[model samples]
Target chain A: MKLKILKSYLNESIQHVSKAISSRTTIPILSGIKLDASPNGLTLTASDTDISIQSFIPAETDGKQIIQLSEKGSIVLPAKFFVEIIRKLPAEDVEIEVRPPFQATLRSGTSEIQMVGLDPEEYPHLPKVEERKVISIASDLLKTMIRQTSFAVSTSETTPILTGVLWTLTNNELKLVSCDRHRLAQRETPMETVGEQQFGNIVISGKTLNELNKILPDQNTLVDIVVSDNQVLFKLDNLLFYSRILDGTYPDTSKLIPQNFQTELVLNTKQLVDSIDRAYLLSREDKTNIVKLVMQDQGSVEISSSSTELGKVTETIPVSRVSGDLLRISFNSKYMLDALKVIDSEQIHLGFTGSMSPIIIQPEGDTKILQLILPYRTTN
Target chain B: MKLKILKSYLNESIQHVSKAISSRTTIPILSGIKLDASPNGLTLTASDTDISIQSFIPAETDGKQIIQLSEKGSIVLPAKFFVEIIRKLPAEDVEIEVRPPFQATLRSGTSEIQMVGLDPEEYPHLPKVEERKVISIASDLLKTMIRQTSFAVSTSETTPILTGVLWTLTNNELKLVSCDRHRLAQRETPMETVGEQQFGNIVISGKTLNELNKILPDQNTLVDIVVSDNQVLFKLDNLLFYSRILDGTYPDTSKLIPQNFQTELVLNTKQLVDSIDRAYLLSREDKTNIVKLVMQDQGSVEISSSSTELGKVTETIPVSRVSGDLLRISFNSKYMLDALKVIDSEQIHLGFTGSMSPIIIQPEGDTKILQLILPYRTTN
Candidate 1:
């Protein structure tokens, strides 16, 4: 294989594919990146059994030439060294030539580097998914949905299914739910689909979603997502991301959210976030990470935390509106802070069913995004 | 103690002192920062035995009030939480009040934080350094000198003195030298001393100097350096930094540098650095980090490295001048790269005595900075 490509284009594509190359892969050939050169373009593929990524650089982009190919072949090079060498090359264009014995030579400017390559046949093949059940969404919107709910996924491996976020589609609405038993985050948005097909119970590992988020462009580009029996594929401009779906069914989290509240308060999001953040500093020393919020009839809330070694902190933030009954509730400040950060509205509505029931939080006038947190039982 | 201080001033002072608070210290009280409020100003001090830093915020500066003190007392608070709390406070002005039994209350806007404080008497006091031997230098120059030589210090604790940079003063010239048995970096600068007092063999740990560098202001302010029996004190405006000197005589490194050379090459510093950097990537995989430089009589140098598994890389960078005899030398590319990054010259002069002798490097037309690296013996 012989090809000449722009250094910038190759560097960007290498970065995207390297995210899927795990350093601790058991298969020796899995640590390398497979490169295929054809008349149309050059493709780079990397996988780690659970996730696979492929990036292509066309021969011509817009009116400028991106790659010039003289021959077509395939080879697998160690991703670790190959990526670094390409990034540090001193020239604008890099030329790569592969020999019969699986040896690749890369030349740029006055530097010439030769690296051993493995046979492309040793690499694993990517999983195939049909495009029949595909949905289209803006790349930025998908990134936001992942960021808002992915953090709530359980990090514990004891329950393997909880480590993934559940994706459900009904009619034209798409919902994502992530729960770690202690707290839950759910985000819903309207998506465009090819056909009127309803799908549910498609659970994807939160880690895979995060990697996909990093590679996705922040611009408003359309991304096509295809869901199959046990595999999902996300197709961007010239990139493809595939991940294996979890085997078990996701638990129903809708019942955990309360429909009505005995107490409700609406306040500025930043002010409440700052108040709880300060109180969290004190509670962190106690290791319980518990902070209490006392709602008063005067339309103000007292946020406080104390530790035996490090005194205490109390903050009073005024609420814009309050209703129902006055109550005192204790919950993990980290969970509250995480939920507050994802809310895009200036003001947030926090509702409490009772002292021990789950608390519901959402943007002031938006019902699409909802966050639920379980209260901690404490003797006061 | 009762005082009202500007949050910005308090936060800056706390940041400076917190650098000396070591989290792994055996003494529990050493993890706290001691705050003393007097009629004149508020003083903050933190010590970790090996180093101590103190910052003072005066009651008034530049005809403006910085602190308002109603009462005078002292207390020590955990530096970790105190620094973070001060940085995140929502108000411009912060009021701190101390009650009986070392309880401190910090109030800013609607937030009130009460933290348990240790008795100030338990904190270690700073060492007393007499002004008998002191030297003055520009803060920027001192930072540059440290950066140029500190990276050469030995990180292994086997030789404690080698882990420090030797500071020598003679004839109003300050010199710093550091060597790790393989490579050495030396920098010298003319200083305006208090008197013609010559001193030598004062070694300070590289880690301490790094911490000091982080806190030093970038402006061209004059810094006072006082040397005692076993301590060195650096005074910069309202800040004082004290560090313990390593016990032992530093080895003489002058003999390692050669005055005459068998081959000489003058080339662009950046070009040679880039070429060798690429070759280093290949050598790094072999665990030797060895890169060979062959000076050609045609005014060009060839840099190359090879590994059995990961082929090789060769780069040819043109030099402006070449003299003496053609020579080939191999050395650790990392040491050469580190030394090149610190030289403040676009053109560098490289001198070689032979294939096995130490090579000398200095900035073109500059005599104040010199670096020496021992060449590796190679079969080719």
Candidate 2:
């Protein structure tokens, strides 16, 4: 294989695919990025047995010759070194020549690097998918949904299913749910489907979702998503991301969500979040990071936290309305803070059941985003 | 003790003193910051046995009332917690009231914190010095000198003295030298001294110098530095830093630097540094991170490194002139790159004694800074 590609174009494509390459992967081949030079352009791919990423650089872009391909073939190069070399290469064009005996030579200006390349046949191929059974969503919406709920996914691999965010599609509505047992975050968005098919309980690892978010741009254009029995594929522009699904069944979490509220208070999200954050400084010395909220009948919410060893803090935030009865509740301030970060709306409604029950936080205008937290019980 | 200080004013002073407090210190009192409130102003001090920092916030600054003192007393609060609390407090004015039995209350608007304060007598007192010997220099230049040579100090405390940078002042010139017996960096500057006292040998820990760099502002203003029998003090503005001097004689490194060169080359400091940095990607895998430079009298200088397991990289950098003989040498690329970083000049002169001897890298225009690197012998 022989190809000459513009340094800038190749560097950009290599960066996108390099995210899937793990330096310490048990599989040695997985640490290398697969490069295929064809007439269309050059395709770079990297995978770690869990998630795979493939990015394509066209032969020409904006009247500039990006790639010149000769004798199309494929080879795997060390992902980390290849990317670093491309970024630091002094010249504008990088020439890659692969000899038949598994030797690849990369040259830019006066610098030449000869690396031992692995046979492309030994590398895993991109997962194939059935096209018709796919859903489409705007890239911006998908990124938002992942960012909103993915943080709640359990990082511990003890329960593998909990490490992934559950993606469900029902009645053209895509729902994303993530929970670490102590707290839960759920987001829903409108999705378009070509065929009338209901999809539910597809577990995608939070790690892969985070990597996908970095690769996806902020454009509002629609992107295709194909979910196979064992793999899920996200197709955007000229890039494709394929991730293997977690094999276990996700626990049903619908019953844990509260359907009604005992007391509801609406206030500016930023003010409420800041007030709780200020209260968090005192509670941080404790293990639970518990901060208390007391709703008053006079439309005021008093935030307070105390550490027996450290000090105590109390702040009052005026609320628009506080009905039902005066109530006080406490919850982990970190969980509440994380939930507040994803709420984009200016106003947010917080629903409290009791001092010991789970409190719900959601944007006032939409039911699509919801955050639940189990309150800490304190003997006042 | 009762006082009201502006949040920002107190926060700034607290930050400077907090640098000396470490929670992991063996002495429990060292983890607390002592606050002394008098009719003059408020003083905050923190110490960790090795270094002590104190900053005073006057009752008024720029003719504005910043700190209102009602009563005069002293108390010590947890440094880390107090800093965070004051930083996040919402109100502009923070009222601090210390009651009997070492209980302090911090109130800002509706937020109130009651923390357990420690007795000020438990905290160590600042060392008193006789106003006999002192030296003054630009704070910015002193900071730069610390940055250039501190990285070369030995991190291991095995030798104890090698972990500190040696300061020698004589003939109105201050010289700083640091070496780990592998690489050495030396920087010299001119200063004014109060007495005709010659510094014999004083070693200050690199860790203390690093912290001082962070706290010291980068300005041309003069900083008063005084050294006693066992302590070094840096006085700037309203802050005072005192660190215990290492108790040992520093090794003489004068003979280690070569005075004459067998071959000399002047090149763009940035280009040579960048080339070595790129070459480091492959060199890092080797045990010594060895990269070879081959000087060609007829052509460019070749930079290459190879690992038996990984492949090899060969890059050439053009030079303006090459004298003496065609030389080949291998050295740790990281050390060379570090020396280049400290040069701070556009053009650098690399003076080589021989293939196995140390190479001196110095700025083209001045001899104020010098970096010496020992060459490594490559097995393969």
Candidate 3:
């Protein structure tokens, strides 16, 4: 491959693909980013079996030439060196030339890097994700949904399917759900679709979703997601992200939410968070993260946590409203804080069925988001 | 102890002293911060046996009442919980009351924390650093001096004294030197002395100096330094930092910088640094950091590094002046980069004694700072 490209564009594309190149990959060619230059443009592809990312830079963009191509070819260069050197290139334009037997030289200003490139033919081929059942969603909305739900994914390898967030689409609505043994988070949003399209049981690795989130555009552009039998593709502006779906079936979490609440209270989100945070500091000392909450009379609630050696912290804050039976419950304060942080509301409504039941929380008057945490059975 | 103190002021002092608290300390009492509240002010102190820090918040400062003292007493609270709780206290002013047997209750707004405090009597007492010699220097200048030399200190604990920076004050000048065997960085500046006062071989741990640098004021206000037999005390506006001097004689490093040179070159500091930086990235892959420098007869220098498996990177930049015979030298690129990064100059003068001799580098037309790096023996 022989081409002269703008350093800025080249650097951005390299970074986009570099995220898929894992340093721990056992395969030698998988540790590199494959580069292909042709009449269409320059495409950079990297993969580590589970996830593959490809970013492209056209020869010309908006009447301005971004690349001057002398020949069409393909080669795979080690991501480690290429990423760093391209970022520190001294000039505005960088020229890359590939000679016989997979040898490439990158020249910019007075600097020249002669790197031993791997044969691109030896690299793994990207999974062909046919555009089967494609659905479009706004980037910002998808990013928010991922943030709200992915944190609850199980990190244990014993339950492999639970390590991914389950995605379901039906009737132009998209929903994402993640649950560990202790806590569960669910976020649902409406997606605009021209036809009746539906897909379910699409479980994507939470770690891969985080990588996609990093490259997701901040703007309100549309992202098309294509779901196949076991492969999912997220198409962005000039970029393609492919994530493998977990093989096992995801557990049904619908029955986990309680249909009725014995006690519910509406409280200021930040105030409750701050009070729980103080109690959390003490609870963390014991490594139990057990903070107790008692629904008090006259629209008030008490939060407390104690360490056997560090003593106790207690605080009472006024709630906007309280209904049904009063109760005392204990739960993981860290999980509560995480749920409260992502709730985009000034007031949150918390519901409890009994002392040992899961605590249900959602933004006041909003049903689009739900977070639940199982209470710890403490022998008061 | 009973006192009502503004949360902001109390939080600031706690943070200042918390730097001295080490969580890994085997001693339980050393993990807590001692609080002494008197009619005059409230003092917070923390120590880890090696270094101690004290911060005082006056009862009133600039016509503002920061503390309202109800009684005078002292107690030690676990730094972990106290620091975090005070920071997230629910009100602007927090009231702390200590009962008999070191049980303390902190009240602010509607929050109450019952903490089991350690007896102040059991806390380690701060060493009295008698003022045998005192010198005043701008806080910014001292911070810069620490940053320039401390990076050269040995991180390995084998030679314990090499982990500290040696301080020498004589002839109305203060000099700081740090050497890790392979490289040495020295910084000096004239000090205003009323009398012929001098101190030498005051070696302070580089780690402690780094902690002290965090709290140093950014302004050009003068900071008082008191040196005693075994300790050094730094007095800031309202903070006192005490550092234990390393109890060993420092090696003589003055002769490492050669007075005469076989080849000399002067070049733009940024350009040379940039060229060397690119070479360092490639050299780092080999884990040897061995980058080669070749001086051209026509006032240009070539910087290159090669990996057996990854190939090579080469860059040449022009120098303003070149004298004597041209030479080729190789050294650890990381050490050279560190030495170059600390030099505060636009133009740097590099002097080479021979292929294997130490390379001397200093700012052009200045004798205040000198850096030396030992060259590596190479077959090619």
Candidate 4:
């Protein structure tokens, strides 16, 4: 394969694909990035056993030449060294030529580097997805949904299905739910679908979603997602992200969220976040990470935590409004902080059914994003 | 102790002293930072037995009150949590009050944090150095000297003295030398002395110098350095840094550098560095980190490295001048890169004493900095 491409374009594409190349892969060729140069464009692909990523640089982009190809061929080069060398090459354009017997020479400026390449035929091919079952969603909204729910996915491998975020689609409404037993996060949004085929129980690994989020552009570009029997493909711009779906049904988290609350309070999100963060330091030292919030009748809340060796911390933040009964509840501060950070609102509404029941949090007027944290039982 | 200090001033002072608080120290009290509040100012000190750093914030500076002290006392607080808490406090001024039995309450805005503190008497006191044997040097030059020579210090503790930089003072010139057997770096600068003591062979650990370098101001402030029997004290403005000197006579590295050369080359420092850096990548794959430089009579040098499995790389960078006999020498590219990064010159002069002898590097027309790297023996 002989091709000349801009350094910046290649560097960015390599960075995107490198995220899928795992160092612990058992297959030798899986650790290398497969490059395919054709008359139309140049494509780079990298995969581990679970996920695959491919980025394409067209021959011409917006009237400017992005890649110049003299021959069409394919070769696989070690991702580790190739990525680092490409980033440090001291030239604007890099020329790559693959000779027989799998020898690739990369030339840029006064530097010429020759690296051994593997046969591209040994690399795994991307799984094909049905085009008719594709669903399109805005990239910006998809990233937000991933950020809001992915953190709640269980990191423990004991329950494999719980390590993924469940994606459910009913007609036009799309719902994402992630639960780690201790806490849960769910986000619902309206998306455009191709047909009246309602999709559900499609669980993608939270780690995979995070990688997809990083490569997705921040703009409002449309991303088409196609789900096969066991694999899901996300197509954005000239990039394709494919991941294997977890086998097994996700637990129903809908029953965990309560519809009504015995106590409710609305407060400034920044103030509450800051107060809990300070109290968290002491709670972390106690090894319980438990912070108590005591709601006052006069529209104020006291947040406090104590450690046997580090003393205690107490912070009082005024609430904008209060209703129902006054209550004191203890919960993990880290869970609360994580939920508060993703709620994009100045004021947040917090609902508590009781000290032992799960607490619900939502943006003041938005019902699309909901966070639930289980309270810790303590003898106070 | 009761005092109200500006958050920024307190935070900066805490940061400086916290460097000396080693988390792995065996002494329990050594992990805490000692805070002393007097009528004059507030002092923060942290020690790790080997090194001690103290930063003082005066009650008033430039006619503005920096610390308001209502009571005079001292206490030791846990450095890890205290430093992080001070940085995140949401107030311009923080009020700290100490109760009986070393209970400290820190109040800022609506947040109040009570932390258990250790008795100040249990903390190790800073070592005293003789003021009569003191020398003065510019802070910026000292930092430069540390940077130029510190990287050559032996990280292996087999020879403790080799892990420290040898500080020699003759007349009014200060010379610092560091070597790790393979390569050596020396920097010389002129400084003023309090007396004609003409001190020599004061070795301070490279690790201690690195911490001192981090706290030194960038400006040309004068720093007073006092050398005692086993301790070196550096006094800069309101800060005091004390470090234990390594015991043993440093080896003489003067004979290692050659005054005569069989080959000479003058080239752009950045160009040679970039060329060697690229070659280093390939050499690293071979597990030797060895790159060869071939001097051409046409005023150009070819840098190359090869790996049996990963092929090879060759880069030819043009030099402005070349003299004496043609030469081909191999050396560790990392050592060459490290030395080149510290030279303060655009063009560098390289002197080679045959293919096996050590190569001397100096900034063009400057004698203040000298770097020597040993050549690797190759069959070719």
Q: What DockQ would candidate 3 receive versus the native complex?
A: 0.82
Better of 1 and 2 by TM-score: 1
Residue A53 lDDT in model 2?
90
Specify the CAPRI tier of model 4. medium
Q: Which pairs clash (backbone N, Cα, C closer than 3 Å) in model 2? A: none
| Candidate 1 chain B worst ten-residue window by lDDT | B190-199
Complex DockQ per candidate: 0.83, 0.69, 0.82, 0.78
Q: Each prediction's Cα lDDT score? A: 0.93, 0.87, 0.94, 0.92
- What's the i-RMS of each model? 1.0, 1.6, 1.2, 1.1
C-alpha lDDT of residue A102 in model 3:
96
> Candidate 3's residue-wise lDDT over B176-212, tens digit each?
9999999999999999986889999999999999999
User: How much of the true contact map at the interface does candidate 1 reproduce, as a fraction?
Assistant: 0.85
Q: Is the docking of candidate 3 incorrect, acceptable, medium or high quality?
A: high
The reply for model 4, stretches above 4 Å from the true place, is none
The TM-score of candidate 1's chain A against the true chain A comes to: 0.98
Off by over 4 Å in 3: none
In candidate 2, clashing pairs total 0
Q: What is the docking quality class of candidate 2? A: medium
Q: Alpha-carbon error at A199 in model 3, in Å? A: 1.6
Give lDDT tens digits, candidate 4, residues B1-380.
99999999999999999989898988999989999999999999999988999999999999999988899999999888899889888889999999989999999998999999999988776887878788888899899999999989999999999999999999888999999999999999877666666778899999999999999999899999988999999999999999999999999999998989888889999888888888998889778999999987677899999988778888989988888999999999999999999998999999998999998999988988999999999988
Tell me the deviation in Å of residue B122 in model 3: 1.6
Per-model TM against the reference: 0.98, 0.97, 0.98, 0.98
Q: After superposition, how far is residue B132 of candidate 2 from its true place, in Å?
A: 1.3
